[model samples]
Every structure is written in C-alpha cells, then in structure tokens.
Target: MSAAALLSPSAPLPYSGAITDVAGIEVGHHTDPRRPTGSTVVIARDGAVAGVDVRGAAPGTRETDLLAPGNFVQQVHAILLAGGSAWGLAAADGVVRWLEERGVGLDVRFGRLPIVPGAVLFDLPMGDARIRPDAASGYAACDAASTAAPAEGNVGAGAGALVGKLFGVPHAMKGGIGTASVKVGGVTVGALIACNPLGDVVHPDTGELLAGARTDDGTALRDTRRSLLRGDVPRPLLAGTNTTIGVIATDAVLTKVQAQRLATVAHDGLARAINPVHTMSDGDTLFTLATGRVPLGEEAPGMTVLSVMAAEVAAQAVVRAVLAARAVTTAELAIPAARDWPGRRAAA
Candidate 1:
C-alpha cells in the first residue's frame, strides 16, 4: 500500500478544527494572576486510550513512562498542562482528586486511581516566582471544565509564557494557547498547544517570521533562525526558561502504538512554526488521546492519516497562539503583542 493509504484508507486531510470535535472530551483552565501561572485540564470522564511523546532536552513531565505502548494501563482519566515548570506538576494531584471524587479512573482493589499524565513549561520570570500553580489550581480547572471551545492566548498554562527568548527577555514576545482541528475521512483530529518556545515562531508555508525576538527598538521582528545560521549567538537563557506543551485528541479508535505515532508526528507541526524547537531550554511535549468512538471499518482511515493531519494542525495552532497572544507590560518588562508589530494589524 502507498504511504497515504497506509496512514488512512480515505481521501485527503481537510480544514482546521478543535479538539472538542472529539465527542466526550472536555477542556478547562484556571489562571492564577498572582503568579500569572495556572493549569489546563483535559478530561475524558469515561477514560480514553492515551500515549505521549517528549522531545525537548529539558522536559518536566509526570507519569509518562506508564504511557509506553507496553505499559499496563490502557486508558487515562485526564491530562494536565500547566505553567510553573516542575512546581506545576502539583496540579496533577488536584486532577486526581477531582477524578476520584467523581469516581473516574482505573480500578485498584482498594480505591480507583485516576491515571493523569502531565507536562509543564516555565513562566516564573513573568510573574511572582514564589507564587506557582498548586493543587487548588488543578481542582479549580476541573470545576471549570466544559465541552465548549477552550479560551486561547494567555490563559491556563500559556499564562506568563514567552517566546523568542534567544535574544533575551527584552526582545521576547508573549506566547499562549492555540487550538486547531481537521477532518481526515470520517475521523476528526484536533490539537491544543501552550506555546513558549526558546526561539522564534515562523509561518510554516511562507517561512515568514511570525513572532519571536524583536529588534532593539522592539517595533520589528528579528530572525533568530537566520542569526543562528550566521553564528550570531546570544547569551544562554536561564534554566527552565522555555517549553511548549500540548494535546492531540481524536475520535478514531487506535492502539497505544498508533497513538504514540500520532504524537510523534504532531511534533513536526511544532517544528514548522517554532524556530529552534525542542531545544535544551525547552521541555516540548505532546500527548494523544483517542476516544475510540470511531471504528476502523473497511476503507477506514487509520494512524497515518491522523499523523499527517495532526502535524499540520499542530503547526497551525502554534501560529494561532502567537497571533492571539496579547502584549505583557510591567514596570520591569514590556513584551509587544503580535498586533503591535509595525504594520502587523494592517497586514492581518
């Protein structure tokens, strides 16, 4: 069979979409303005088959090993994406408690254990480092869950996120949340991302710089990738300064291996939009959740189709995130909004 046929037994991939397009999947966010850090929760109340891929050199993740194809668990109750770097992992505890209260999770002889896998990106520098996401933040996110389209840009894990830090904070731009989906045959694949890469964001199709480090005047875009190619290196970013975390959801039935493949391809989307992605400063990670609502009948599109669509959707979501991001200014810092770019609004 040809590659496309192996990927999916269907026609081609179609329009941008949302993760909620997958039935039974819900999303929620809780932003903590104190530290400007918060949590985002994706819940599969009925539980969903899940897999994960962590590519960045400095990832901060929880419970990912169990997601391997050979692990015992086959389904996950929820996935947590949050700010506050390693400290944000505490948010998963709240998610677990919420699931337990609702009687969701895998059955242990003693009590039901909610299977929650999570990842975090650094945002401490943007807000109060002393104040970070906690268990309460996770619980609050769960209470706020809804099937409606999730709020994007500077919410949840995206709050306090920054990009284009290669040239330092004065040149970096605000990064935030973005979502997109597409239809491949009868299957629907969607992606949601919290963008905060260490490099610049680029347009995949045109190779145009979308967002990233700005010129000294902070009125124009700077090409970090080109600078790197020319050996124009900047000082090292601080530890835990970047990451981009996201989730991929689909209505198609897939095995753990297939789900893993889907996540692996999703990173291609990130790479397309973010220059120098998966860097030592970034903890880039993606997770895939299959609701198993659609069966693989004859001529049914399979993993390959989902993978292709996922990569595109992911790339699109990255652009959407930077596009939707608002400027962040304090007495100490002033990150320009995408719209604030010279002639950016006019072009848009």
Candidate 2:
C-alpha cells in the first residue's frame, strides 16, 4: 500500500456533525520518557461500566472471560492500556491495585467482579529498547484517567509502533493512535485505534492505497502486496508484529451480551478498512462499550444506522492512522530520499 496522490476523500458522515453518544467518556495516558511506551483507557461514567470481546490469535487480553454473558460485573471501575507486550500483563496488577485502593470491582459473594477489562498490542522489540514499561508506569496511566481527551499519533502504547515490518523493523511506516467519530440518527458512534497492522491501510472510497511495507531501494519505500507477489518477503513467524486493537464507544444502552455482539460486528469494520487483515501474524481485536447513557430507543432507526456508520468511521480511522504515522528509526525501513508521506494532513 504505497502512498498515493492526494486522492479524493471518503464519503462524509451520513448524519449531522454531532456526536450524541458516549457522554463524559473520558480518556488518559501516561508516557514514560524512559522508553517510547505508554498506556490508554476509555473511562465510563464513574468507571461503572461493562462488556468486551477478544478476537486476536496472539492476544494478551484481560478480564475477557469475566465479561461472559451469564455472570458479569455491574460496573467496571476502570480500564487499563499499557505497553510491555505479553509480559506487560504485569500492568494489570497496577490497575487492580489502583482500583482496589479506591474500592472498585465486582461485589461477588466470594469477592468483587474485578472486572477491569483491558487490551494490548505489539510495540516492544521495535520501540525504544533502552526504556521498557513497568508496573509503576501502569499505575501512572490509570491514575491519570480523567476528562482529559486522549492524545493521538505516536503516543501511549503506540508511541513505539512501527508498521510494514514483515521482514524486520526497517522499511516500516510509523503507526500509532488514531481516532474517528460519526454521529448518526442523533447518536454518536466513535472509534479509537492503536494501528499496528501487518497489512497495508488504504483509502476505501478513492481506492488509492495509503501506506504499506517498503523496499530498501535507497528510498526504503516498497509496496506490500507487490513485494510479496514478487516472492520477496520476510520470515514465517512474526509475533506482535501486526495488530490494530480498539474499542467502539457508544452511549447506546445494550446488555453485556449485546455489547459483546457489537464487538464481533465491529471487526467487520476493520476488515473493510485494512488489507490482508486478521492474519496469524496479527492480533487484531475490538472491544465495544455501551455506556447506557444515551437512551437509545431500542434498535430504533437512529441506533441501527449508528452501527453501520460506525463501520465507516472505523475505516477512515485506519487511513488516518497511516497518515499520522511518522518515519521509523529502524534502519531497514528508513528511506533516505523519501520526505514526508503523501496524502497526509487531508484531515477534518
């Protein structure tokens, strides 16, 4: 997916430009300058929330099983996002400790729900080698959660993101946090993603590819599919190499089960946006949250259309992620001649 000319943009929002869902859904991030790593979370009203889904082969997920249908937590005190790869699971401990200090989680007979659902992506090995995320960092991330709007593009867990590194970290694009929202039928369906896909991201409507793996032809820029078609690719195993994890935040009221179902449907949004997605090399996952704030009138025409519109928002987000990405320090993916990427800054 080579960057194309500033082709035409995708279709505009089908509804009036106003996000009616996810009221007071706050976000926060803690960046440890010691390394190019961090964490993020979408805070619900008072952190009392629900629902999640795990759809990645090599996912380092948390609280997913607890989010099951039969048994669940009424309110989720907090959500944690962090770096550290699978080992970063330690970060959850920080969240637990933080929440416990504040007295949150399930009030089960044996104990509480401890329902601090979370997700992670691959940024290690390719990120700042000297600086690694740890428990303290995780606590800081969760402690910082508030009405502060989250930062996008190369921050948080995505601070160290590098794309198109099929063969290695070199010849990869700079991918990080990206977000796009749509308001339909007086309801808002917004998407936030930390893009680190193995495949190339493309412009859905214009059909002009945005960003992909590159060759080390002095420019260090090459087309992902074309190179693979030519039989010039990387090794077979690439863990934590490709994944774009995210969650669709909505104020639409849906049961925990219903929210999980929406998460499954939301993956379709990813499929329509990214090329060669959901590969074994990719740990692609999506989590949906129905805050039950927007008194959505059942599957009213407004909310139903919101679902479809969410798909479009997700696709556009992938495009934005590619453009927001910067050049990688990885020697292999570096392009001596290439300046800034094309079709960039064509944003709203």
Candidate 3:
C-alpha cells in the first residue's frame, strides 16, 4: 500500500497520532542522565491479552515463553522496552514491583504477581557502558506513565539508538522512539517502535533512504542496499548489538491465538521500512496487546482486516522513528539525525 493509504485515517474517524490513543493504555519513559540509555514502559493497568514474536537470532527477553497460546497466563500488565542489552532486562523487575504495589497481576495464593514481559537493545557503544537501565529506572518510567502522547525521539529506550551501522558506528545516524495510530471502523490499532536496526530505514512507499550508512565523507547517505549490490561488504558488528523492538496494540477483542497471529504478520511492516531486518546480529522483537474493548469475532475476515492495519501502522511508526530523531554527539562519536542530514537538506 502507498504511504498515504497506510497512514491516512479512515473516513469519518481521526487518529490521536500516538499509541496511547488506544483506551486503557498508557506510556512512559525514563532516560538516564549519566549517558544516552534508558527504558520505556507500556502499561495495561487492567491487563490485556498479549502475544509476542521474537524474530532476531540474538534476542534478550523476559517472560516471553509465558505469552504462548497454550500458556496458562492469558494477559499481561505491562511491556518494557529498554536499551542496555542483556543487563536492561533487570529493569522489568521494577515494573513488576510497581504493578504489584498497585494490586495488578494474576492473583495467586499469596498475592498478586504482575506479568511484565520485556525486550532490550544494545546502546552501550554510545557512551558509558557501566551506566544502564536498572530496576530504579523501570520504576521511574512507571511513575511517569501518562495517557497523553509521550515525547518521541531521544528519550526512553530509543535514547542512544544508532542506525546505519553497516559500515560501522562513524557512518551511522541517531535513532529513537516513534508512535503512530490508525482507526478502522470501531477498531483502532497503534504502534510504538524503538528503531535501532542494523540496516537502513527507508520510506515504505517510495523506498527512499531515510537514514542509514553514510558515505566515507559522512556527508551523504550511502544507500546500504545499493552498496551491498555493488559488492561493498559490511563490517562485522557484534552479535545482538542492534535491534528494532516495538509493541502493536488495538482495542479490538481478540483471542490469544489471534493475538499471536497479529504479532507475526506485523513483521511485514518492519520489512517494509527496514532493510535487512531480523538479521543474525540483530534481536528484532514485537509484542501484540488487545484491550478486548471492541467486539470483533475471531473470524478470518476480521483478522485479515486487523492484520493489514497492524502492518501499516507498524511501518508508519518505523518511519516516524527516524524522522523524529535528533542528532546526538558524544565525546568520542557524533551521529546525525535524518532531518539534519546533508542529503535531506539538499533535497529539500
């Protein structure tokens, strides 16, 4: 579908331009001041049917297995996305604690045990590796949760995100978080992505490079696909150092199995906007959450429609990520944002 068709609101209904447009969902972020790394949390206070799909080979996640269709757990209280690689997983503990304090989670014999699933991306290369998101960071994010549109770019899990590293860090651009939502009849679907892919971000409809590896002179986009086609091999990046993780949510009612299917098909959006997604060196993952507010039967046609909308919103969210990103420079390295790139300025 064309970008306009994918992004344009359906007739008679308008979108809130954020994932929080979905009822019963809230978003929050905690950016560490020590360096460019932080955490983002998506909370479903009353709990929502959830499913996850981990496409990258080197994924680092928590409680994902419990989200399986056959698993006894049917819902999740929150989903956490953070930067710090594996160590960032510790942040989920704080989310669990915050939810438990609020009496949210599956009731057991002793007390409520919140179910918080999460994924992480590597940003240690940007600055101080020692300073990463921890339990406190997660709690702070939850404390800041709000229904209003959360700030995008250079915050939350997207802080310190670097893209177009196929040629190495020096040739990369800054990446960040972005959110978008769309409405279809009574159903509304939204996506929030923290884009840090190993490949380039491109316009889904036009296929123009938005951000990626820069030329040797660092003055223009290198066009990763063309460079590879011309036999320009990429430098070896560390396994699990790159990823694009996000959450897709809707107010439509859906079964656990259907939610999983939605998560699977949503990867199409990633493929549309990201070149060479789900690579061995990347840990791409996506989660689906259904608020069960709108009644849409678990029939083939209803699922088909929701699936299409899911992918469209996901792709749009990816594009917004790079566009909203701002430049970030450390003492050791400087990464430009797509909006500030010389090629983009020259084109404008």
Candidate 4:
C-alpha cells in the first residue's frame, strides 16, 4: 500500500492523528502545480500564544522577531509555511490582509495589524524559478482554510519539496506535508510539517531510512549518515536548497517561555527522524502554539510530558510526509516517491 493509503481513516489515531484534531485550529493549502509550488496557512484565528525555535543555519522567515517572549505582541493571528525560499515570504502579506479585513489583529491607535509569522523552504530549483508563491496564493490558502482534516503529501509548502540532497538533486527523494496528533489527559497536541531536507528521513523506532539519497540505479536506499561517517566527501550542489519547517500546537495553556521550550524540545523529533539535520544547508524551524483552552497541571512534569509528546508527534509527522508524497518530475529534477522505494516497500 502507498504511504497515503496506509494512513487512511481506518488507521489507528492515538488522538485524531492530525493537526486539526486540536480545537480552534484550521489549516488550508494553496497549490499551483504549474508554478509547481504553493503555501499553507494555519489559522489561530481567536489568537494563540506562540513561540519559535530556528535551528537551521540558513532560514527565510517573516515577523518571527515579534513572536519573542519579550515582544509586545502576545498572540498571533496565523502562521504560514510556503515554498519559493525568501521570495515566498511575501505570502504572509496576504495572510495579514486576510486577518485585517476580518478585523483580527493587535489593536493600535488608528488600526489593527494582524501578526502573521511565516517561514519558507527552497523549492525554486524544483520548478520554474521565476514562478513562486505570492500574496494571492496566501490569500487563497486562507480562503480555503478548514477545520477538517488537512490534505497531505505533495500539498502546500511540500509540493515542490525534495529530500536527501546531501549527495545531489538526482539522488534526492520526494518530500511533502504531514500531520499527526496525540491526546493526553484531555489535552490534544498536534504537529504539521513540510519536509525538505539535506539528510535522510528515518523511522524512529527501527532506524530504517524512509526517504533520502538513492543508489545510482534508484532501486535502493543509500545511508546518508553512513556515507558521511565513512568520510565520503559530497560534491557541493545547491547549498541552502533544503529546510524542514513545522508547527506544533496544543489546547493546553502554557507560558511563552514554556511554549518556546516546547519548540526547542520538538527539534529532538527532527533529529530522531532526519540524519544530519540542522545542517548549514537546512533551515529547520519549529513553532509552538498554545490556545489556552486546557489548564496545564501545576507541576513541572506536566511540561515534560507535553515536550515528549511534541517530539513524538513531530517525528511521526515527518515519516508521514515521505510516506504520503508522490513522485515529482521537472526539467531540472526528478524525485521518486517514498512508497516506491525498495526499503519502504519491503517494510510495508
């Protein structure tokens, strides 16, 4: 069975196994195959306390500074994940405008300015470089936003995403959008990710590579970590051609510092699933949002449990991304689907 099919409704959901499983959170995607790129918006419309942790050496982001604990803005209207690298940050403008028109945002003396923090992944080389996500795309994504289960694999920011590029583009595999959630003590925590990285995606439990570099014949998997340990030098391909950006959310109330801590621990999920993560070439970032719906218990262990759950869901979401991805071919690149990979097929 394909990865998308395997995670069907019949599949077990510890929680809803989706980001939308969290109440008051809506997600939407705007995909343009012609541009072969797109954008995704996560609406915290009622406003949610948010924090970010950027681990990638190279990143493209907008308005993240405002999300800091010391910043004046205490909440954000939405979060955007898009393709087109730095150029894609423009998509946030549409999201800001969407909130503004709806009368949502921080109230100032004259008007309200919605706080929209966003990040971008490198997908320009996968398609026509000139064609990228724009303000219109962001607006459309918001318009299509829904509380229903999000469409995964080859959608939104991951539409043009390719993974395991430590070797080169030709050896990389298709990556996409994925989501998973877990419920604990009536509090639901969920994660949504766009997987486009420079290293291999691995199954956390078994340590099996789910997606990454392939053999020259494209018939087998290559251990990206193994190659690096062997001192096999990699050719300098397109640097900064990768990033994995995601958001983890919960209904549990948390302080800004705790939210930031959640984002920090969540990187453990990225490290568990991807070999050579947070490299200079990748912009691996994670954001945490708390809706303040559920009261966190008055104990340090409660935060620890939330952090552990966050990492678990993040890793699971990354695996789902590759599993759901379909192959993509462009003039400059051809990325194989994870389902077709020999290792993945055998494991399935």
The candidate that achieves the highest lDDT relative to the unseen native structure: 3
How much lDDT does candidate 3 score? 0.88
Ranking by TM-score: 3, 4, 1, 2
Candidate 3 clashing pairs, residues 3+ apart or interchain: none
* Backbone clash total, candidate 3: 0
Candidate 1 on 216-279: residue-level lDDT in tens? 6676676887777788778677656799999999888989999898999999999999988998
Q: Comparing 2 and 4 by TM-score, which wins? A: 4
Off by over 4 Å in 2: 1-21, 45-49, 108-114, 127-130, 218-221, 229-231, 298-303, 328-339, 342-348
Candidate 2 lDDT tens digits, 96-141: 7766667666566765444567777777765455455566767777
All candidates: TM-score? 0.92, 0.82, 0.93, 0.93
Looking at model 2, residue 199 earns an lDDT score of 72
True lDDT of residue 347, candidate 4: 17
Clash counts for all predictions: 4, 10, 0, 0
lDDT of 2: 0.62
Give the alpha-carbon lDDT of every model.
Answer: 0.84, 0.62, 0.88, 0.86
Question: How would you encode candidate 3's per-residue C-alpha lDDT over 239-344 as one tens digit per residue?
Answer: 9999999999999988899999999999999999999789998899999999988887444238888999899989988888877778888888988887665664
- Candidate 1: minimum summed lDDT over ten consecutive residues — where? 1-10
Q: Tell me the tens digit of each residue's lDDT in model 4 across 87-144.
A: 9999999999998999988888689888899999998878789989999999999999
